[model samples]
Target: MQNNYFAAAPKYQEDSSNQQTNTEEQQIGKKAVFYYKMVAKTLGQYLSIYDGKTEYKMGVVMHQPAKPDHQGGFYVYDSLDQAIFADVPLKKDGLYFAPRTVIKCACWGDKIEYPNGKIAFEYLCPVQDMGMPKGYLATKAAMKEAYQLYSEKLKLKQGAGPKSLKKPTWKN
Candidate 1:
């Protein structure tokens, strides 16, 4: 799939006088976007997220954090499909989630597969911020498994390309 640029429109460059400089936040912002894109190319491949019209982003609904990195109490998910998220006018709103059928990240807490072949993940990270792109307990398992597998394949001297030529996670 092509890159899903940020939720907002891109700000193009202008003349040198008005050109944009890379501030720390800007750099981190770019890295964050890249990290999200990496997610799309790797674990996203195993998911059937594209619903024919709108390509819903993988949104993580988390519980309160307490024991881990301490970034929490922001998103307390009580429902699989947020009422505000359903049938949204394609790509217009960014606060919504794909549904229980999508949003397959392990960081969502606990993954539950229904009998209808639709998968749902619960928001269970009450003590840790499972929202981080990496290093978090949840991301290490199913989240980045595809990337890890692709890396292992590359090490065997096999003519293997990336699960999309995936890049390493951003560092501060």
Candidate 2:
């Protein structure tokens, strides 16, 4: 005969405080930087983003629910060219249709709900395919302009001008 001292005891204490802290941390870490809307078509949805260096193609799953128990819906592609080249549809369950968009974020594994309150998707950081960082081209252009202005100012200080110097050799 053995004495069961902990048989009926709670297997583990429910730490509500820890759970609350975790939820808060998760919310703080899951902020979206930008979002692109992708309308689903009879075939599928596609999103192409060029961050000046790389092109990212984010595909959307169509005619399928995020979960087995989720309500069915349809998404029609807005572009005729895309509709013509979309993948084959899987299921035709719901008559209600709308465009599904993918939210882009810097953090991976972040989840966001759709405006319709029906679907949610996990955000994946596509940094590898993100190519150049955002605003890189614009910043580059600004820097180039500033350099040109500085060169012009230096030339002026050196008593060089259109009347005294030859036409600026550098092309705009």
All models, RMSD in angstroms? 20.2, 19.1
Worst 10 residues of 1 by lDDT: 32-41
Estimate, for each residue in 1-172, the C-alpha lDDT of model 2 and write its tens digit.
1112123112434385654233432453345233322222223422322111112233321122323233322222233333223332333442113222233323223243434332233432222122223332223335578789989988877768576564555678
For candidate 2, list the clashing residue pairs, or say none: 40-75
Quote the lDDT for 89 in model 2.
32
Best by TM-score: 2
Error of 2 at 12 (Å): 15
Candidate 2 TM-score to native: 0.22
Cα lDDT tens digits, model 1, 113-165, are 33433333323211221222233222223436867876787764454555455
Q: Where does model 1 exceed 4 Å of error? A: 1-20, 23-25, 33-99, 104-172
What Cα-based lDDT does every candidate model obtain? 0.31, 0.33
